[model samples]
Target: MKKRVVITGIGAVTPLGNTMETTWNNVVKGNSGIAPLTRIDSENFQVKVAGEVKNFNPADYIDSKEARRMARFTHFAIAASKMAMNDAGLKVGDNLDGERTGVWIGSGIGGLDEFEEQHKRFLAKGPKRVSPFTIPMFIPDMASGRVSIELGAKGMNNCSVTACASGANSIGDAFRVVQNGITDVMIAGGTEASITEMTIAGFTNMTALSTNPDPTKASRPFDKNRDGFVIAEGAGIMILEELEHARSRGARIYGEIVGYGATGDAYHITTPAPNGEGGQRAMKLALQDANITTQQVDYINAHGTSTYYNDLYETQAIKKVFGDHAYRLAVSSTKSMTGHMLGAAGAVEAIFAILAIKEGMIPPTINYSTADEELDLNYIPNSCKETSVEVAMSNSLGFGGHNATLVFRKFN
Candidate 1:
């Protein structure tokens, strides 16, 4: 029989807060993490605002000298992963076998800050001026590599880079690794620190970022006036352990991850497949993997990026999959508040899904003042809802047409 996997611990460093509880509490209150872009000066840019992780201190989690050697993305990953391992009550080389505990973290555009800084030095003072750690700091996979080294994880260390779906894909891949009995535990999720001048200008030029001057009103997902997504950065890590292993250690279970579905939209490099066909298939596939019908899904954490196509197409996809039952279930986009965390979006949102199940409260899609006619759903708009959710589904659709869905059920 396939091994069953359960989430025993969770961690996150988000725009809302540096720790998971602070972030979750703010989310439940319909608070907006989106604010004026302070990470970089927006004087020369059209995009005036973004969701930036405020007041974060890497030295709080990593040694000051050691943290300097890693990129910002790796810093976030390490902090979150350490928090997760602590939450799971497992220490370095303790309570778990290092050979069987792995790390899988993803980044869509890893270390853009590192790259920009190094390139500036290279131009100003030649290649020799560039730090020797340039490659280690700029690579996407470095998050996983450094995490494994720091945490003593020796099993399947990997990274996924499928745009916004990177986090979910990494978690899904890690799930399979444990389910297949290749590992007993996996530290898996995604991280991103790409909120830099080049990334912002690139996304702005493509009209993929919100140009709204008011940060509070910018990321209004499902609202009729949403222009584009406001990019953000963060990391979310989860400790996924086999049920038997968790029970043996008497670990606290958050929820059981029962299903994972991943698909690609070969139709476009930057847009979702027409009518969200890929997303629809991914959701259906996850339900099948979970052996549950559409009616059994109580909540759906949407990949609602607040863009025109994503909001409309995702609504269509949900309706197509659930049919009339779509309106009956609650669907909300935490990105409406968190902004789009890019690679970290899925992992953080997955934690939100599980929290919704555990706390019996669904986070709201805030800033939803005006709604689109065709994009109607419960949304739980502008206010949190206290409801018992037996099964929660989180969907992540990314650029390059990546679609991923994960199903988390309330543990008995």
Candidate 2:
């Protein structure tokens, strides 16, 4: 029998808050994190609002010298990892077997801020003006590498980069490592900090961001007014441990990871397949892996990025997979509040789903003024609800047609 995996600790740095408690509190309050762009000059841009993590001082987490060598994404990842490790009562350079504790983190794009600065320096001065840390700071895998090096985890160090699916894929992949006896404990999640001029311009040029100037109303997922997704930045990290290992050490278990499924649409790079075929397959696969039917799914944290295509197709996919049972499911898109975290979306939403099960409360999908007639379901609109969720699922669809689903069951 395969070993079971459980989430013992969690941490986050998002637009809603820099720490997990503050973020979760704001999320539960149905507060919007989206605001006017402060990270970059937005006076001349069509898309003026985004979800930016505020007041994050890099020197607070890493030394000045080390901080300069890492990208903003890596800095966020390491900072959150430290919180998660501390919450789990684990220590770097301490008693745990370094061979059994690993780190798996991911990012959609790494060090855009660093790359932009270095490129400017190189153009202004000469080639020697570019810092020697430029290459290491720019790579996507540096987040995982740096966290592992800092924490002294000698186990499987890896990164997942399936665009928006990066975070969930990384966490799911890390669970498999411990379930298969490759390790006993794993620190895993995803992070993103690509809020530079070029990054915003690229997404804006592609018409993928909502141009609505009102930050509070910009990211209305499932609402008819939703123009497009609002780009956001942050990191979400969770501690996954073998069930027996957690119990042996008296670790607090938040929830059990029951199943995971990842698939490729093979249809389009940016657009999802018609009617969410890839998303449906991912849900079905996750259910099969969990050895349960669609009727047992109590809630779903949807990949509702507020885009016209995603909200409609994802709703259709849920109905297709669950049929009438879909009506009984409480589906909410926390992106309504957190905005879309891009690569970090899945990890943050996974935490939202798990907390829903733990707290027995369904978070609200704010700003749901009008729902499409074709897409009808219990989306927990506008207000949070008190509900008993036994099993919850989180969905993430990424660019390049990658679709991933994860199921979390309340541990008995």
Candidate 3:
């Protein structure tokens, strides 16, 4: 028999707030986290706004000396991971079997800030001037490595790097580990802190980022006036445990991860496949994996990146997968408020989906002013809706044609 997997705890360091509770409260309120770009000097860039993690102090979670050695992204991951472990009431050597626990965290552009700083030092001074910890600090997989070390987890330590889908892919991959009985528990999620000069320049030149000066309305997903995605940074982590393991430990169950589907468009490097065929396949595969019909899906946390093609193609994918039932499902983009968190988007959005099931409240896609004729669906616009979301699906599509879908069902 296949083992069952469930989420026991979740933690987030988001642009809206430092903790998951605060972030969720603000998200439900339809508040925007985006503000004037503060991480980098905006005088030289057209993109003047971002969703930066405000008031974060790494010393709160890590030792002052140790925190200085790691990148800001790793700091967020460690803090969120610590919070998640505590929330799960899991102690590495006590309740949790250290040998049966693992960590899998993902990031798209990991430690870009650190890399830029160190490179400048090398260019201006000398190679000797570069920090020795630069390699460990800048690599994308260090988040998982550091989390495993901190938690003393001895099992598989892995990281997924599927651009924007990194977070969802990491969670999905970790879910499979527990489902396959490879491990009893897994700390999984994604983190990113890439709000730097080089990142802004690259995305700006590619025309992938929003140029809207108004921070409040910059990340307007599915809006007719939406131009591009607003770059953001943060981390989201979750504790996934086997159903029996959680039950035996008397852990608080948040939701069950019943299905995961991952696919590749193989069509475009950045833009989605025509008609979102890959995304359609992913959603269909997820529903099939969960053994559910399209009508059973109550909500979809869409991968609406606010980019014209992403919103349009993702909508087409939904319609293709659900057919007429797509119109009935509540689809919303939390990115409207949190901005596009790149690598962290999937994991954070997953938390929102699980929260909807736990709280019976569906979050809204704020800043939805003008509607498009072709993209018609119940977006739950402007305000939160109180409803029972028995089954929620979260989708994440990445730049390199990577598509991942996860289905969470209310634990019985």
Candidate 4:
């Protein structure tokens, strides 16, 4: 028989706040973390705002010398992973079996900022002036590599780089590992620190970024006037452990991870399949995996990127999956506040989903002033909702046509 998996701890370093507690509190309060772009000079670009992590001190989590040598994305991964391990009250080779503890973190564009800087240095001076750690800093898997080393996880150490679905995919894959009895505990989630000139320029050129100068009004997912996603940077980590392992350790459970569904559009590199057909399959698959009917889900954390196609297609997908019951369920896009944390969005949103199940309060989709008739689901517009959330689902759709969904049930 397959083992059961439950989430014991959560950690995040997001634009809304540096720690998971602050981020979740701000999200519940309907506060925006986006601001005028300070990571890069926006004077030359059309986009002027972003959800950038603030007041982060790398030395707070990792050795200052090692932190400097590693990339910013790795810093986030290590910090969030440590926070999660601490919250889970587990230490490899101490409280838990080192060989049974693993790590799987994801990042879409691992360390583009570092690469851009190194490229500039190489161009300005010579290759000799470039840092020797450039390759390690730029690799997407470094986050997982560093975390496994730092935390002494001797089992699987892997990273997924599937664009926006990176985090969700990582968590889902890790879930499989634990469910199959491959490991007792797994550190899973995603991290990204790609806020840089190149990322901005590329996104701006593709018209994938919001050009609204007002940070307050920038990221408006599902709003009729929504323009585009506000690119952001962050990391979200969670501790996924076998239920028996957790119970044996007396670990506090946040929620039980009951289902995961991942799919490929195979339609386009960037554009979503029509009506989000792949997304539909993913949701249906997740429901099937959980052995639950559509009406059982109380809330959905949409992969609402504040983009025209994602919002419309995802809404259509939900409607198709849930039918009339979709009207009864509440669906909200936390990106309205978190501003699309790219690779980290899925994991962070999953954390929000579990929290909703645990706290019975669902975060709102702020700046949802205009309602799109085509997308008429209950967005829980503009304010937090207090209710009994028995089950929550989080969706993540990535640029490479990756679609992932996770289901979290209230722990008994």
Clashing pairs in 1: none
The regions of model 2 sitting more than 4 angstroms off are: 92-95
Q: How would you encode candidate 4's per-residue C-alpha lDDT over 1-412 as one tens digit per residue?
A: 8999999989999999888999999999999999999998888989999999999999999998899889999999999999999989998777899899999999999999989999999999999999999999989999999999999999999999999999999999999999999999999999999889999899888889999999989999999999999999999999999999999889999999999999999999999999999999999999899888999999999999999999999999999999999999999999999898899999999999999999999999999999898989999999999999999999999998999999989989
List where candidate 1 sits over 4 angstroms from the true fold. Answer: none
Model 1 per-residue lDDT tens digits across residues 1-412? 8999999999999999999999999999999999998888989999988888888899998899989999999999999999999999987567889999999999999998999999999999998899999999989999999999988999999999999999999999999999999999999999999989999999999899999989889998999999999999999999999999999989999999999999988998888888999999999999999998999999999999999999999999999999999999999999988999999999999999999999999999999998789888999989999999999999999999999999999998
RMSD of each: 0.7, 1.0, 0.6, 0.6
Per-residue lDDT for 361 in model 4?
96
Off by over 4 Å in 4: none
Lowest summed lDDT across 10 adjacent residues in model 4 is found at: 86-95
TM for candidate 2 is 0.98
**Whole-model alpha-carbon lDDT for candidate 3:** 0.95
Residue-wise C-alpha lDDT for candidate 3, range 277-315, written one tens digit per residue: 999999988899999899999999999999999999999
lDDT of each: 0.94, 0.91, 0.95, 0.94
**Per-model tally of clashing residue pairs:** 0, 0, 0, 0
Per-residue lDDT over 101-145 for candidate 2, one digit per residue giving the tens place of the 0 to 100 score: 999998998788999999999999989989999999999999999
Question: What TM-score does candidate 3 get on C-alpha atoms?
Answer: 0.99
